[model samples]
Target: MNYQTISITLLILCLPQSEANDEAIRLGLKQVELSKDLNGWKPVTQSKQIRYGEWTTNAPIGQVGTGGGWGNWGTSVVWEDYKTVTSNEFERASLNNGENGLRIQSIEPFVPSNATKYYQEELGSFIISPRIDLSTTTQDSLFFQYKSNTKMNLEIWISKDQDSYWGIWEENPNRFRNHISATVAENDFTQIKINLHDLLIEMGQIFCDNERHDAVINPETNEVYIAFVAYDNAERRLGSDPKMIEIKSIWTSSYYSDGQLQPAPIDPVISFDHKCSSVTISGRVGETYELQTSSDLDDWKTSYSFTLETYFETYPISDFQNTTMRTMFFRLKHKP
Candidate 1:
């Protein structure tokens, strides 16, 4: 390895933009998979034996009685079948590791498109995980994979209460609203590993009749109930279509506090993707790398390179010859 002081900022500005660019993909991201052993969790069903109670939706959109629909949670009656067959312009989603995931879907065929009047949809699923004796373990962060094309609407909550029940705003330490619809990126199979110790508290004010249903974040660990929801109002007249979501392999474990997502000493991993007419090279932060392409993998020639200065995860990869004429293979190697 060559040891020399290099100005990362100046190098980025001086580097010419190339049609075929390379990036560093983050490593150590592990998606928890489910097994036959119940994975130490009891799948709660829609039976009286379960402690889950009546489910309701968010606040109405425009006039009263306009948009208010309550959602029910059940282990037996959920999980919509997702397929990858002859499909068109719609975005597609799949399980992260295996065919085990929870799907929250609704076939609302009649979503009136009106710009002047704001529109909202009924969205919520209250799920209580089987008794997890975290009594002995220290949780670092929560991890899961999610994807959808439901007009980009989905949210999730974790409650401290071991038993499933409804509570008002008065319950502060009981609920922790971690992820929401608007915050989730519309990627196909995005993996999220949230560090609980460093996790910031996010909350919102919704309603249950006259009573207020709000989100509260707590620092202290507690046995809880996780709720997956897809409730948000349309800011404008959205394309009238079905709204849905699929969340798979929700798990909690000790997270590795490596600075991959941050701007620090990190390894670069490359992910080549074809978007639009060109390719996209995605990578993690840190380190200078060289990306080369050649008809034969041996005589590597054409290349454009850059060190990920900031945390931008994507750069357009372009200007490669058509595969019909000559097939080009790309590679990203760390340069000393």
Candidate 2:
């Protein structure tokens, strides 16, 4: 069994780019700021409990609303006053809307534990989600609404293992399968939707070992875990403070509903780069495609099957060649 790997480390730093074309394969990032329709997709149910840590001051357990209904689970760690303690004042506050929604201030700086000794320190906080079922074949999607009075950086992470816990207090927290960054909000509740399969391909394991490995979600065998991490630097005032970024109404769903007419599949654009001796294909993310080889251009054999994590992908032309042939033809085919 040969599993494919997407290596961000080698792709950018180590991989050699050919001058055949001055440009490299690039994919336009999905726009999360725009509002999206549910498209008949149902909301994924969430367990109403915090997997780790206690609620911050003013944020009590079991708050209500779409945001508060899902449960607020968060923790914070700080390098403060020069002396560290178990008690934290800068942890994320959970708000009640029906269920508790996690909140982090972008305007107010955290007071140093020892204000006398040090002027500032560093603070890290995160809100984690309970295990949820997200499948690849069905085009499962994650949706959430967020409101921010100020700009805030948010790192979203996913893991297939249910036991994988991420907390600032943990000695060795588990590494998520993939992660991506996004701005929290633009002063109001903004709806965002991300396809699960697309996310795995878009963000391939960056927090773990340097070696390349497959980041897959096997719904039959595993449940998915997600976490949102935010950082604050008091020394430099590099993070959000007084204004808050609130996340609520988080859910997952299949891209289409039952009997919904599927959209027409788009064909992949294939081209050859003689200088690099490679074949490049540009296609939509999450769509599985195949590269085929033929001796006479009539009987083509499938050589490789892959889903585009990015908008554009390139493969060495030599990999599809079985023998030193005088002539060989190649084509790209969409899979279903």
Candidate 3:
């Protein structure tokens, strides 16, 4: 062909406002077909995997008995031991999973030597986790087994500074790795998986971009940097603590979405093509899509349906060769 023919072809390929036409290229062939649509659902062929297992081993962050001060007020470069950090409230226990877990005991309320207005409000322990990079993950969750004597509460926190637990909590925006509160009130050795995304949303609401609707979440600034913190926050009553909690086989894993945690269904890509006198609808393989067209966007009519046999199969597109309109809109519905 000549330059004139090439120019016309490029124009035809680029004319549509279709999302794919914008970022694609055509080689010796026609326009590179459109990309998959974002709205439809795809099937997840396999279970979610820990692309990178950051906490698979017994790698506690700080050295035991190295933390300092009351209520964890010291610069503990290492993980403080329960025996040393908890004013005699926490202990280390062996888990049936062959991994170690934490044990928290209720202690008698100490109103301080000078039981004055400054009564010991609570007794607790703090331990740091090795640096964790949440940058590449869309989901992060904690899995563990715990048994409680009475009601027990704990906080999972992140911090940029290894020593700014209080500073971060106090809204020193630059230091704190927002905290998530969890509680266990039962006595059975129950297993629990805590998804962190829910709590992160709350943190974003309070500390993200000062609450801007159009604000973008910069994971590099917001999540890339942080050390994990697991600590106890036991409220003291007059009686010896009853609602005690012991945890075993503690670790964190990152996945893509809530569905990815188990066998999940993923949405496939949907797109369409414009031909000489008809429209072609297509989708990825091993998936079926319903094609619908509408002239006013408000009302739509089903045109046809097609399913791809293989991921690479040249699946035929649904064609509409008998129509005449200045413009048209198409939407796709995925079928399991």
Candidate 4:
């Protein structure tokens, strides 16, 4: 309750404040974290080597040849007797759910210049929505796997709204975005990681494609949406052949921090009063160190550089400078 007691208490509080600020600065420079496990993220479309809707649509359509039967012009089959050749080709196949109301189409391949046949439809399209979260402590990372029987290109869209009205993410227009054209190995699941910071830097606007792009940060409400489209243009040796693509998985994970600052696999030991001089530099192997000297703590100068060797080896300070009688403050920036 007296002045001495009050002064001591204030000093203790001030000490913690300085330490906290220092820790913040250290963490702010670099931060990275990896997910412990990846699961639960949903995929819009997941198929195997089968062409998009080929197994059910094109195959059945091919089975039922162009409807025409033996008949004479003069004595043609009666209109009433003619059975309506119903085709259940596409009906049996699974179609896109249209959650985001995004439209997908299959385009026929353009025939060679010499060929009389017009372009034949062979490719299929679909959309995928990757889960993402934007928060101070929680960061989102996206991973997905894709495989194709034939070479194909994947296009992605990111939006703040479900409707196609507002265009938030695009590749060709030179708008802020990031896309990688990966040549898929035959039937292989390609894993990809989408870092939150990288996405924001690339996309000038956050959740621009969503209706509430600007509101993503509001505590009351905010939403971000991402979609993907795939196009295949494999040549068909025979007419009515089917092409296929399969998306294996789509996943997202959260970590303790901003998803940066990886922890070291091994523990490190600490030592103090390391003597460094003009002839020698004292430092431990596999560690970051700073040689600081000060007549007063207010002003300090770094005299020698510290570097770790390949293997754990003792470094002598005799090579850098001669230790003077005065005390010097030397510290190591032990980054974990």
Candidate 5:
């Protein structure tokens, strides 16, 4: 008697599952906020002059009226043509509260008492990360810790394929923001973990005309960088409490699924129950899975999808028995 084994695979979940004892490589600024220093990380700005100092309302000339101008008030940073600075030649950007991590808070528009047109000033900063190396990873996941005001709209952008600047990317400049805001309480820090492949899939759905796109961390990739831009224009409203955002750390880990490092595949246990004419599959309890079937092993179709309430699931082989087919194969897939 020939018995076929059940196959399993991973599915993306809203919340990531944890695998015990997995180490992560710290990404971006290496605890800069913990040390109370911006380090190599800097806020995006227009003027190269105002690098280090107290956050001010001083807007440089040619940066006031229209083109990149918010009357020199607030942070002189904009989404379009965003640039980053490093090295002593550039001024250092300032954050609030050394004990509370790197906080970039919104400010009231520096409306000069004599100004004619108040071109809605930008209040918050768009901090960019230093060039990150993803070339070493075939697939990876990210873990980060941060907090923000409820009204704050945090946006993220990526630069890949050796882009010259932080805001720039090889293709598709679309922005990506995870649904972490729901879990984050006002002014309270929350930590989140996400698989990069899953994030790329989400980005492709939202940005690429609803088409599936290729993963960004393949072998051909040369350079990659991530920018955490906190510019909630809604937070700029007058008489509203100032909106702020802060970051403590960012790190990446090798790909894993269902609390286990993956590609070290964990196969399911299968046994035939001839007395009942059924097949039993034993796997980690309380996990969701998709059951698929194939006739020629080339074309597969989903037969059943469900979550396990127990350590084992049993099904009548008659459910999948085909009269005309001599051979049939079944596989079970699990999503983390």
Candidate 6:
């Protein structure tokens, strides 16, 4: 049998935008920074200089009435401290071992009367003025512990710009919060991984409760703030409201430098070499292609390419040299 060699090159276009976003989300999760142990996470109250329960008097607050009482509610809380540690306190506190956890002991109280009378004392009951940097390439995960006995209400908010223009991203209006319950015991840590993109999606859902929503993507500026607010369903005492719940630990992991979704690396190029009667093709394991042969070099004929099976077989051609006289060339054209 006489053998003639023919070589062909194949080119593939870029992937679709949706496929790229999916790949980015997958890789971004894998590149999480600082999966710290929960044990290493110390409470924010541990800072001696920052007094505990020093609530601000001018913070923004929100309220939701469940049935007969203020059991299920939502509000934003804010505090000012001179210490650098607490400056970005919430973000810093979120960086803990996956095993470490946080829980809500009690929720801040706010009575919502049908009347719009100004209650100066209740004005700033809860305020969260978080500085969200759109520039940061970090993926943050949060875990909030809640008792199974009580109804749990929670909400998270984010602002691409500043708190003045903040908006809600995730909320559990009246449903019991779902958490990774532990076998160890009550009050132990239960974790939830919240990606930045997820945060954006959740916020979009909140903004578009009745319509469609879109998430913004810009890497040039810092423009987002995040907030986590919870409510207690337990009854209150005479002397005081339920002791404010404590957040055990908050964890964060840094991601791709740009902080936006990215596409996966391009797959290796595929090419084939045909020796008239014999053809050898090289390609990535998962890539697919279709081989072809031509007599006039203008109109081509289809042949087999790589498949799930180890190697692809082509039909045997008789008189390789004589066939090439009529069919002079062969090429591998990738299938769409």
* Global lDDT of each candidate: 0.40, 0.45, 0.38, 0.35, 0.46, 0.35
**Top-lDDT candidate index:** 5
Q: Name the better of 5 and 6 by TM-score.
A: 5
User: For model 2, where is the 10-residue window of minimal lDDT?
Assistant: 21-30
* Winning model by TM-score: 5
* Model 6 lDDT, full chain set: 0.35
Query: What TM-score would each prediction reach against the true structure?
Result: 0.33, 0.36, 0.33, 0.32, 0.39, 0.30
lDDT for each residue of candidate 5 in 1-336, tens digit (9 for 90 to 100): 999998998896765323221334433212333343555455663322111222334555545655665664545432222123221111233323323345555554232333322334333455555554343454555555567655555555664432532332211124334422223522365655544545654443443232212222222122355666665443222355655666654554321123533234345555665544556665555567777778989998877767754344555656666777678787877854
Stretches > 4 Å off in candidate 5? 1-36, 46-100, 109-124, 161-187, 201-222, 232-241, 252-336
Alpha carbon lDDT of residue 189, candidate 5? 56
Question: What is the Cα-based lDDT of residue 196 in candidate 4?
Answer: 41
Q: Which stretches of candidate 3 lie over 4 Å from their true place?
A: 1-86, 95-99, 108-120, 149-151, 163-187, 197-202, 209-243, 253-336
Instruction: Estimate the Cα RMSD of every predicted model relative to the unseen true structure.
Output: 27.9, 23.2, 28.7, 25.4, 21.9, 25.5
- Lowest lDDT sum, 10 consecutive residues, model 1, at 18-27
The candidate 3 region of ten consecutive residues with least summed lDDT is 25-34
* Per-residue error (Å), model 5, residue 126: 1.7
lDDT string for model 6 (57-110, tens) is 332235435454544344333432231111112222231233222344443333
lDDT of 3 by residue, 1-336 (tens): 555544443444534222121111111111211122211111111111111111122224453433542243333332211111233434455434433455555444433222222213244444444333343454544444456433345444454334433222211123223432234423345544444445444544444234332222223222222222223335443343545556553444321242323224444444432221123233443467776778889887777677743221212232442257556776777853
What TM-score should be assigned to candidate 2? 0.36
Per-residue lDDT of 75 in model 4:
21
TM-score of 5: 0.39
